[model samples]
Every structure is written in C-alpha cells, then in structure tokens.
Target: MTDTATDRSTDPQKAPSTPPQGGQGVMARIRSYTPTLRVQRVLAMLLLIAQGGITVTGSIVRVTGSGLGCNTWPNCHDGSLVPVAGAAPMIQQIIEFGNRLLTFVVAAAALLVFIAMVKAGRRAELKTLAFVSGIGVIVQAVIGGMSVLLDLQWWAVAIHFLPSMILVWIAAILYTRIAQPDDGTATRQFPDLIRILAFVAAVCLAAVLVTGTMVTGSGPHSGDAGVGMEGRLEVDTRIMTYIHAAAMYIYLGFTLVVAFLLHRVKAGDAAKRTAWVLLAMIVVQWAIGLTQFYLGVPRWTVPAHIAMSSVVVAFSAFLYAHGRVREGGTGTSPTGSPVGDARLAASRA
Candidate 1:
C-alpha cells in the first residue's frame, strides 16, 4: 500500500503492457482494418471466377483421360506427393496433379474473401454465403478424391461436377451482396410474381445441368482411357442427349419468361443487364451443345461447354439476387423508414 501501485507503474517488468503502435495483435489489426467496398467486391469476384475456372480445369482432366493420372488420392501416386518417373504419363500426371493443385487456389480465394467479409463486419447473409462457398471448395476436393478412389465412375464424376455449379451460384450471390452496406434494409427490386418465375427458371437450369452430366456419363469420354466404357452409365448416349436437350429447351423457355417479366417491370438496371447477359449465355451454350451433338462431342467443345455452364449459372444467380437487395442507405429500417424516426415514434408511443 505504500506507493506499491505507483512503483509497479514505473517498473517496466511489472507494468501493464500497451499495444504496439500499429495494433494490439495480429487479429486485432485485421479486425481494425476495414476493407473498402471496392476491395471487398474484387475479392468476391475473384472467388466467383475461381469457382468457375476450376470446373473447366476439371473438364480438361476428364476430356484428356487424365482423371486417373494420379491413380490415388491426397498424393500423386502410392508414395510420392508429386509426379514420379514411370508412374504415369508425364502429361497426364501434370494435368491431373495440376487440377488438384487448383483446388487449393480456389479454397484460398474463398478464405480471403470470407476473412474480408468478417473483418468488414458484413451482414450475416453475406458471411453465411462466404462460409458456404469456402466449405463447398473443401467438399468438392473430397468428392474429387472419391471419384479417383472409385476409379472415376460416371456417377462419382457427375457428383464432383454438380457441386461446382452450386458453389458458383453461391459466389455470384456473395458478389452481389458485398456491394451492399451492413445496416441497410432489404428491398424488393421486382414483384414477387417475377421472383417466383426466376426461381422456377433456376430449377430448370439445375435439371439441364443434371441431364447434361448424364449425357456425358453415357458418352464416349469415361474420364480415364484405361477405364474405357466399363464404368460409364448404361444409358444410351443418344437418349441421354435428347433428355439433356429437352431440359435445356425447358430451361430456356422459363428464362425467357423471366427476362420478359423483368423488362415489363421497372426492375433495376443491374437486374435487366444480368437478364440480357444470361440470355446470351444460354444461346451460346445452346450452340455449343448443338456442336457437340453433331460433331460427336469433340475434346475442345467439352471445356467450352463446361465453362459456359458456369457463366450461365452465375448470371442466373445474379438475376435472382437482383430481385431483392439491401438498400445501402443510412439508418433505414426493414419498413424502409429511418431507424431513428421509428425509434423516436416508438418512444412517443
């Protein structure tokens, strides 16, 4: 009690510590630095692109018969983490291993954007989207390994591909949400009727994707040249193609209806623009599908077709998300009134 506290304050070893000039700690620094809207949007966009790009690379591994190039999961071969001489063809090993490596890249991008969202104190919806997207990358990696372990069976391969589309959709929505402020009220940009129509269109797109995968499963490419037609789906390729094409037409019809309604309504510019871009993507995909059907599904068209699939999914998600948006205005309540005004009124009541 005799000035002990004062002595402790003066003694460096006994004194309470102060944070460094920059920040208290690494996490504190990260939490203190809020990312700009532009930076956050860019990170979201990168995640979206990575989600889409990885699918195309996976297609490359399939079309080149390199699906089994590694011949194992979590490792290049039985013992090596990388390519080894006389293990597999150099090109196949490189293609398969490289595709696996890209999974990490996609995961890393998702993690960065997610961390940015958390640091920026984004809304729960945005954070959830980022979390799901990051988780999806890990799930996809596991599925990919399963496909290899199962000798690249048609169903396993199809399973691996479908989740990528879902991740793309999630990333697209995240990109849209990152532009909004955390405290803003959610507003509908279009009528509920139109939103319902968009939902139906999205469902049709999913059907198209599933049927298309079935077509590939039944077609010439069985991922591994050595597997040949043994593990392929037993369905006739022509029948599967017909089913896939029919699903595409239905999807196209529903999308056209959504586009028409979007134009009729005074939807936001972003919504209308996304609708048009989606239409264009659907048409391009149609052309590619036709080319693949007539040309016996060439190797080159597979990647193009897969890439366009990602684009279509992204734009479709963008259009749907435009139906409802966070107003990004100050102190707005869910009813579109100022939060302060509402609070004052409540106080008066």
Candidate 2:
C-alpha cells in the first residue's frame, strides 16, 4: 500500500480535461444570438422593402390628392388626433392615416438595423451601412414633413424621393457583401470595361431620376396645372417630359450592356444573378413608364411606376457593389481583404 493512499499530487501525464457539456451549450446560445453577416444581409433586405412600400404609399397620397387630407404635420385638421368628421370622410382619412403609420414602421425598422449592426461586432462595413440607413430614415422623415408643409413643392418632393434611392443602394451593398462566395479565386483586379460600364449605368440612373422628377412636376401629379396652362404643353413641362423619356431609353440600353458584360466575365453566380435581376427590373420599369405616359399617368400607374423604380435602383446598386469588390474579397472584413484564403482552402481540402 506504501504511500499511495496518502499521495494527493497530480501526475504529469494526466490528460487535459475538456469543457463540460453545459459550458458548450452556453457558448452555442451566445453564438445564436450574435448578429452574423447573413443576419445583417437579411435585415438590410427587410429595410429596403419597408422603404419601397413607404415610397409607393407616399406616391398614392399624392396621386389620389390625399396629401392635404391631414392639413397639418403630426396631426389631422382641427388639431384632432384622428381625422375630423368634415375632414375628407373616412376612406381618404384611412389612406392618409395608413401612409403616416408606414413612416413610423420604417423608422422602427431602421432602429432595429442599427442595433443589429452593433451586434455584428467584426463587420465594420455592414455596421457603417446600418448607420447610414438609420440616419437616412430620419432625414427622409424631415424632408417628407417639409414637402407636406410646402404644399408638395417640386424641389422638396424630389429631395424626398432621392433618399429612398440611397437607402436602396445601401441595402444592395449589404446584400452583395453577405452573399459573395468565400472562394479565394475571386479576382481582385476589375476590368476597365466593367468600371466604365458601372459609371455609365450610374449616370444613366441619375438622369432618369432627375427627368422623372421633372415629368412629375410638369404633370397633373405635381398639384400644378397639367401639361398646359393654355392648350399647349407648357414649354417648360414639355421639355422636361422629353428629357425624362430620353433618359429612360438611355438607362434601358446601359442596363442591357451591363447584363451582357456580366455574363461575358462569368463573374460568379451571385453577380450574374444580380445582373439578370437588374435587367428584368429595367424591362418592367420601361413598360410601366411607357404605360404611364400613354395613359396620361393613370391613378394606379403612378404608384406602380414609383415602386418599380425603387426595385430597379436597388437591383442596379447591388450589381454595382458586387462588381466593385475585388473578385475574391469579402468586403466584410476590416481590411477588405480576401478573408482567410487558407481557411477556405482548408475547407475545400
């Protein structure tokens, strides 16, 4: 028996102990709650949908002459929390009220995105995007109020439209960053042709938006005298409409070209898919634009056109962001490096 019964010291050859099952379970719970790149991407998409809905509803408010239904910011007529008895009846009040409710929803969505960004600790790029989207909602709300207060002045309305487009772009970036494959083979070097194509597409998009604003300002939707004050298309309005149509055609061409190049480069499945989506949106948008023009801006077509434009801008921006990232780079990491090529290679191995 010797000293064995009294020996309390541990042996040098003792194997190391692993963490307990309960400890591992806690770690798994922590990971589940942590915001990941995929979660951020999903949040961004949700925010985009909200923004698009808001844009469409806002257009409905204008197109239906419901903009003035409330007659005040943050309140209805007579300072009542709800629409008064004489205040444009129930249907008008409901539509206008619904539009107001959406603004709050959009704001709430943006706040959630901001919180998620903080949780995704390592993805600085996504964090910045969420911050921008959050700030954009606030600015958009302010601009929107001003539009109503100013009687929907053309410039104020146009400014309000611009932010929605920016929000769409931010969402697209978030989408691309998360969806990009982690393979090390993505080329960092962008072809000059691709860069040129992106630049042209961006220019075309801006022109289309500006011309659209002009067209709206000139049309009945602007709450102004439509087309002519005296039986002829007002010189100013006519010119603007032509410019808008021209810009639409140019945008259509640019989008098709981008789709062609994207296919030519074989720029991964994600990029190709995005390009195709953009092309489809472009086609649909053109059809709506034409229909709106020929139909003299039918009530239904107005919101439809606005909604389609939102989608087109979002998809186009996705294509642009996907193209900008060096072929293999994740764009999610702090350094924008091709995140851990060795890990990807090891996974393949």
Candidate 3:
C-alpha cells in the first residue's frame, strides 16, 4: 500500500516470491519497482552529453550576437514565453529562443536520470549526483534569466558560461561512477605520483577555463551588440587572451607531464592510453584557442572553441577518473585488453 520504501537494493540470495496464480497483483507491483541498471546508465550518459552540447549552442547565441533576441526572461518579450515577431527578426528570435528551448531538454534529461537512479536503488552517491544535476539545471535557468534581465552584461555571460563548464565536469564524474558496482569500495589504478600530477592537471584546466571566460568577455562578441559594451571587462582583450593562453599552456604542460610519469612508472596500458588521449585533447584545444584569437575571434570558430573546451574538460575529468579505478572493466584495461585483468589478478595473488 505504501510507495515510500527507500531501501531497494535487490538481494542476490532472495528467492523470487510466487504470486497467486489467478491474481498477479503482488508480482506486478514488485516488477514495477525493480530498477534496470542498463537503462539507468544510458540515461546518465545522455544527461552528461546533453549538458556539454547545450553549452555549445549557448556559445552560438553569443557569437551570433542574438543574446537578447527575445529581450526578457521567463517570458520571451513582454507578456508571453514565445517571441513576438515585430519585436525582433525571426532568425534572431529563433537563435536566442532556441537556446532557451533547449534548456527544457537539459531539464528533462536531468529529471529522467534522477528518477532512474532512485527507482533502480542506485547508490546514494549516484542518487545525489543525479539530484545535483537536476538542481543545477534550475540554477542555470535562473542565471540565464538574470543574464537576459541584465542585458547580457559581460559578467553575466561569463557567469553563465562558468556553470556549464562545472556541470559538464560533474556529469563526466557521474558517467564514470555509474560504471562501478553500488558497493562503495575504492581501488586505485595509478600510483601516488601519477595521481598528484593528474590533480595538478585538473586544477590547471580550471584556471585555463576561468581565464578563457575573461578573454571571451573582453573580446568583440558581446552576445548582443545592443547590450551596452561599456560594462565589458576593463582588461585589455589582448592581455586577457595572452593570460588565457598562458593558463592553457600550464594545463597542457601538466597533462603532458602526467603522461610522461605514467610511462616512467610503467603503469597499466589503459592508464597510459587515457593519459595520451587527455594530452591529445589538450593540444587540439590549445590549437583551436590560438586559431580563434588570431582569426579575430571569428563567429564560426567561437562555437568550435566552445565545443573543444567542453571536450578538453570532459577528457581531463575522465582521465582523472581512470586514475581512481578502471572504468567499466574494474581492474581491467580501459581499452578492454585482457592484460589488465591478468595484472589485477596477479597483484591480488
């Protein structure tokens, strides 16, 4: 009669109870509450991907300078959520409002993931992450609205971008954790030195992203030209750009150093491979950053830069994750090579 039962982790040894043959009510109710791990995992991944993808679209809105196309929050213009045709060009409305509409997609993904976690009796860690994701979307929506209300001020736009980066990072963590069993034991793959390097790499990446936002705020694209550019960051765009680039250099430097340490320590091939991918993403992102700057922050490159930013952050997070435990293959090569399992078994023996 009560749906409020919380402890739902299925017992491996419990025999299935047979319901009355003619009336299957009890069995039907029991079946409804069982959580399928596969479905929950898939939903978690989609939420992670969507979190990053929406950030890219948001950049489009800014680079194209349609940030205020709808000119108001909660409602598009004055009285309605939909855009008023006479208030702005149809394309502008579509671009800005489209970004807003996608917010719903983010909300839906986060909601579904949270529901899946609770219903499946996932670990408290996973449930908390999913719940945070849903809450984050709400907070993001409010910040987005504030940006519009404030006329897309440089600071507002910058604030808006920062959270997307954070959510992407969290989503990556969630994706990584979902692969593990609900049992809360920790198994580390990389040694201490490598772990320190990975942590440094992550810290540097955060600096790089913060500086990158400053660079964006000082750059030509104001998200909306109508918004007074007077409020833009006082720092010279060139100087901020250089600072951003320097932070990026540090991030890449640390990541490469980690890769080197991975090799020096003769770590597992999976760890080495993940380190390589992380380094590659950092280098490619740096290239895009340089290109965007030299090309005068062209519109097309803005989205590219944003997209790569997301990719680099996600990759760095995943690398850090692999350092903790082998993703999906617990104690096995992330690349699914049998050697990882062999090594793990050997170590245990």
Candidate 4:
C-alpha cells in the first residue's frame, strides 16, 4: 500500500486522495469576483446609464437640428456605413454619428445583461428584468428608426422619449431588487401619509412627462410642423401643458412633504437616501424648467430640461419601488401587483 501510494503521488493528473463533492468543488472554487447577483445589479445600472446617455444624445441631435443630418434610417446619407464623405458638414456628421454609436452601445449593453441574467440561473426576477430590458432595447431601436424614417414625427418622438424613461425606471428597479438580498423579511413600510405623498409624486411626474411632450410638440424644437393642426395649439394641448406645469409644482410640494415625512418616520437609510435624492431632483428640475422657459427655450436649455425630466422619472420610480404599506404589505409593483407581501408582514411583526 505504501508503494502504491508513492506511485499514485507521482502522477500529476491523478485525482487527489480525497475528491470533493461536485457541488463542493464548484462552490469551493467560486471566487468572489465571479459573476454574482451584484454583477447583475451593476450591469443593470450600467444599462440604465447607457439608456440615459442615449436620451441625452438624442436630445443633442434634436437641439442641434441634426436629426435630419443622416437623412435616413439604419444608414447615413448616401447609404454609407459612416456619414456621407464630407457630406454637409463635419459637425453634423459628428452629432449624427455619435447618436448612432450610442444606439449600438445600448444594444451591446442590453445583450451583456441578457447573458448575465442567464448565468444567474435561479434568480427568476432578475432574469425577467433582463429579458424585459432586452426586449425594450430592441423595440426602442425599431421605434428610433421609425422616428427617423418618419422625420421625427411628434407622436413618435413622444413615444420614444416616454419608453426610454420607462426602460430607465425598469433598470432602476432591477438594480434595487438585486442589490439587496431577499432576506426572508422585507422591511419596506411607511405611514398612510407617506403612501399618499408617493402616489401624488408619481402622478405628478407622469403628468409632467405627458405635458412636456405636448409642450415640445407645440414648440419649434419638435421638428414636426404637423403636430397641432393648422399650427394652432388646441385647447387640449393648452390644458395638458398647464396641467403638466401645475403638476410639477404639486410634485415639488409633495416631494418636500415626503422629505419631511421621511425625516419624521426615521425611515431606513435607503428610504432617507431616496427622499433626499427626490428632493434634490425636484428642486433642480423646477429650477431648470423655469430657466428653460425664461431662457426662451434655448438649444442648450432644451437638453437640460429633458435631462431633468429623466432624473425626476428615475427618482419617482425609485420612490415607488421602496414604498411599502404600513399595514405590512408590499407596495404595488410597476405592473400594480404585490410582491414581498409575506416577507414584509413578517418583517413588520
């Protein structure tokens, strides 16, 4: 037996004296840096950043009147992969090319997220999020192409902006979900007043988005002269725009109230952080809106206004995700379904 042991020890490829269980072997070698739930969260956050970048770039294209620079969808001018050689001007080419490059980047990021989700295996919710984001990226690309092909019609532009905002929100929710481990208990709870404030804030944000679309549609920046029949702002348009602006002030007030409530309840660090972010975003957004209007819609201000709206939307989504019923129920998910209710109840107790 001693001689045999010596012979076995001489073979480098031979199994060790005690082989590990399959699961143990896998677990033992699992490095911390290996793809994990955290990686998925990071990827989701990156994808959101990319989405936000695309929105900003698209705004640049609009503000610069570069929407028509390429003059076609899925291709630049003259049917070339790059912009037309010396076509028009270099600035036009740069802006249009930059926008196109961003689209490709977003698509690539989405694909990476999909792969990460698949590798995550047992995380169903995360996998679903990745799937939704991937689908959203594809649909967004198609709609973007349609916008270009249709010469950036007002409705197309509105839908494009809206869906991208929604995608960002989805990404934000996924990030929060994955970043926090699902302890058997859920700690999300808030008073009735806080719930009402969150609801009002969300409604106000949506109203702001819709009305901003109308305002853009009515403005020269929309790139579509056909929006408002006969170039006249309809009563509906006026009403929506006013409501949208009014909603902004309402949102600002509600957010302040939320900040106060958050302070009163001593909500956890997460909720408090969210409240602060919401407050900052609300203040900045209001200031930007005023500046944009007073500045008479300057090209630079247009993108600023748009960027602020995106921030507000993201914050609103964060608030909604973190909101839990005080009676120990999970707040409604984006699709209006309850999640983590049982866990929340246990935590409340």
TM-score of each: 0.87, 0.77, 0.83, 0.76
Give per-residue lDDT, candidate 3, residue 84: 88
Cα lDDT tens digits for candidate 2, 1-349: 6465344335434545454479786875554444545665677678889988898998888777676667667676666867877767566677777888888888887777777656444246666777788888888877877776776677777888977887877766765664444333444324678767876987899889877876786677753222122222234766677788888888878878877877777666766787788788888888988887777788899889999988988888777776555344444442222333333333335
Q: Give lDDT tens digits, candidate 1, residues 1-349.
A: 5598998888999898777665357766554555656778888899999999999999999999999899998988998999898887989999999999999999999999888767665667877999999899999999999999999999999999999999999999989877765667789999999999899999999999999999999999888899999888999899889999999999999989888888887778888889999999999999999999999999999999999999999999999999888776764332222432343354345
Instruction: lDDT winner between 2 and 3, please give it.
Output: 3
User: What digit string (tens of lDDT, one per residue) describes model 4 on residues 1-349?
Assistant: 3577776789866636674679886775442113455566677788878877788888888777676677677777756867775665667677877888888788888877777655443246767877898889889878887887877777777888888888888877776665544332455567778878888877777777877887876666754222224332344544555677897888788878887888899876777788888888888877877776667678888777777777777777777777742222233322111333332343345
Q: If the candidates were sorted by their TM-score against the true structure, best first, what order would they fall in?
A: 1, 3, 2, 4
- The whole-model lDDT of each prediction reads 0.88, 0.71, 0.80, 0.70
Q: Which regions of candidate 3 are displaced past 4 Å?
A: 1-35, 326-349
Poorest stretch of ten by lDDT in candidate 2: 224-233
How many residue pairs clash per model? 0, 3, 0, 0
**Candidate ranking (lDDT, best to worst):** 1, 3, 2, 4
Candidate 3 lDDT, 1-349, residue by residue in tens? 6333332335434545555664486665544543355666688789888999999999998887788898988999999789887898778889999999999999999998887666555667878989999999999999999999988888888889889988988888888777666543567887987888889988988898899889888878888867657668878999988888888888888888888988887877876887888778777887887788778888999888888888888878878887776244344222122432333344345
**Global Cα lDDT for candidate 4:** 0.70
Top candidate on TM-score is 1
Residue range with the least summed lDDT across 10 consecutive positions in model 4: 328-337
